[model samples]
Target chain A: MLSLFATDFIENSLMKFIQTSGLMAIFSEGGYKYVIMICISLLLLYLAIKHKFEPLLLLPIAFGMLLTNLPGANMFHAELFAGGHVHWDIFVGKAGLIDYLYLGVKLGIYPCLIFVGVGAMTDFGPLIANPKSFLLGAAAQLGIFLTFIGAIALGFTPAEAASIGIIGGADGPTSIFLTSKLAPDLLGPIAIAAYSYMALVPVIQPPIMRALTTKKERMIKMSQLRQVSKTEKIIFPLVITIIISLLLPDAAPLIGCLMLGNLMKECGVVDRLSKTVQNELMNIVVIFLGISVGATATAASFLNPRTLGILALGIIAFGCGTAGGVLLAKFMNLFLKDGKKINPLIGSAGVSAVPMAARVSQTVGQKDNPSNFLLMHAMGPNVAGVVGSAVAAGILLCMLG
Target chain B: MTLFVIDYPLPWSNILLIALFGIAIVFVVLVVLVYIMRLFGYVFTRKHKVTNTKAPLAISEEEVVAIVTALRLYNSALHDKESDMLTINRITRMYSPWNSKIHGLTQMPEHHNK
Candidate 1:
């Protein structure tokens, strides 16, 4: 009886040892790739915190990548969720928090919701006052189509090429929406490229803006925008929704939510709801969207030649888009009367990076002439680019989806 | 899975078609929106101008008197010290590195000196 009791004690101790060492064993099994991926995640986090490069999205994305890659964490498994497919059986287990959240991205709900928030926050007065800005906005999408051909030349599938090309639009939500639909496997690289370029707009745009336009063009000042009345503001979203929805039904979800948010803001009675959508709702969706997108970048998936290709193409796309807008503005200037000519710097704001792109225009314009106030003028094209990109996205979805 | 696979020979016809159609559609739709917006602007501004021109003649002397009386009564109902207090404060623009604190980090050096 004493010998049997001692055997039982020894067996129990062995079981405890195996259970405790399971975590350490994962490192040996996961190999050097995990180390590289973890370092990359840390690099992203450093960029976010230290340099303040899109800290709102990048910080959460970096942290999510870190949490996911930790040995034995099992928070998210990218291999199982490949090609925009989610396996519910595995997702129902203990490691399904990110998988469930990622469903919002997969179904394109998060981006559409984000559009609602953006619309609520945006002021369309400038765009309404200067309707001609829409042409510049449309011209900026030249990069998207041009990149589509370029992606095709690089041997990407048409759907995949469409997804790759939209990174040129420099609209993060639109990029994610199109990529999630057309090329789910490419979502991770495409998203990283899109957000990274967007954050670098100040660095990227100024050079192109200067190269394309002469100092005289940059310093050209325009007449003040006509005052847009409340009635025009209220009708603007409704008219846009009806026309765009009828023309491109695939855009209804994104454009519809945007118009609804704008209507809520302009209707004058739903200020509380508009405020909530602008702040709380936007923050919530951004958190889920960023983290889940980050989790998709597992070591096996991210460290590849295709990701390098995407990074290269992304910069080219942004440059092309900026150049396209600038060139179009220059072309338009050739025809317009003296009083109506535009400062070509406002053209680069046509990439739809919102206030950042607009701010770059103001900064660059002010460099040439300190008295030039280009913020409101730049905003016209900035908001117009948002609509233009959405319409472009709809065209892609209709043809490719 | 798509017909335009990466390995497939370049379908230049299809690619060009897509590019042209996409750009054309965007241009056409936006151009249409421009006309609509212009029309809306014209109609609304015309109505507004007409109303402004007609508004003065439509208001009788009695209505003007009633409006002034009501405004006076509403002003009297306010706190005594707050009534007729129109403060025009000048905003002095100071160019300081600390004023560019978008993220609210790094306090003004003046504060440290204090």
Candidate 2:
């Protein structure tokens, strides 16, 4: 009995044989990763339904997460793909039936296509109407840079730190684009953190906004916006495209595609193309992008010590962004004398989750005054956050890549 | 990164240098963009203010007094407006949840006041 406690395993031939067998080998290698990924999926589901955060994204993301994490989950992995790439194509009659279609993300197609759809849906009128909103947008990104430094200080390489930092964008498409370019291995955890925190924005941002501003400031009424003319609306995206492309040529393709889509949408004459981009094209890309991204959550690639670090840093990035925007708005308010004050809640909308950040802004503002309506006003900074994050992404690509 | 993963290397120092460089770059760019934007906003804002202040006095005192009189008339009507007991008795016959004493007590004031 004493010998059994510390004996060499080979001496127990039957137990040793089982350990070496196919079924047990597969189970031992993959079981823990599957379990942990499943737990994370369940947590996302709980947040989506119970807390009702970014439910549309969380629900699909959680479902895709469940699809990819299960051992031998053929939901994504197929005959064509292995590791993370597609190799030789079958030229013969009897071809491989299975296909691991990782091309959606690996080729870097879905994220850019998603950006086009986002551009089509976005209204740049707010940013153009009040260019100062760009400051809040820029301030919102302090978290990403701060987190990059923190990740590097904690021993992640610069590329790894950059990939991790992009999650703070609160823009999943940008995060995916940067991660695909910078650190493909970290895609799964980085994406999971980005989308998860975006869903938690309602929870995370309100507290930050509350902590930073007083009830009086929250209740401050903003003046009404002048109705943006159709001609100005049509011109805005073109001007932005030129400005951004001239500054960072690396961002040209993305900014160009996005602004082109927006141009089609705003141009009064192209209803057919706009409808297709907004509806059919957008839906197909979102579904493919969601599941394919989910497919990257295989246990072996996802479960690492660094994953824990990425998760912890992600929250820091999000919180810092919120603080930066609020603080910047307060700083600007120094000169705008009299009763006028920039509602600090609008600062959180600068993180670029668009309507989610806007809704969070509106919700926080409502807490101070039931009559205060900030939804439309907050949208200016919200859209600016998208542009700001893209510019920041371009800057990183230039400096690091 | 490759050096640290393989042979012994001072990866920490490299990372520190990269981080500081990134911070300085991002800070300088953001600060300048912010400053220029504020300056432009201020200049345009001052011009807009002068233009706005110069607008005609078209919204005269008579309009204010007329709007106030109309609001007073509506307020008096709403203050006296109420449903009869017969209308309340008819609703009680249609719904059973309205029979709950706790819920009924809370809602009674709103319906009566209205």
Name the best candidate (by TM-score): 1
DockQ of each: 0.29, 0.12
What's each prediction's TM-score? 0.85, 0.73
At residue A8, give the lDDT of candidate 1: 95
Please tell me which predicted candidate would have the highest DockQ against the true structure. 1
- Please provide, for model 1 over A47-145, each residue's C-alpha lDDT reduced to its tens digit, 9 standing for 90 to 100: 989999888888878877777777667777775666567666666664557877888988899999999999998899999999988988888888899
Candidate 2 C-alpha lDDT tens digits along B28-86 = 55455456544544655677778777653656678878989999998877866577665
* Predicted model with the maximum lDDT: 1
Worst 10 residues of 2 chain A by lDDT: A91-100
Question: Interface root mean square deviation of every model, in Å?
Answer: 3.6, 4.7
Candidate 1 stretches with Cα past 4 Å from truth are A1-30, A93-95, B1-6, B55-114
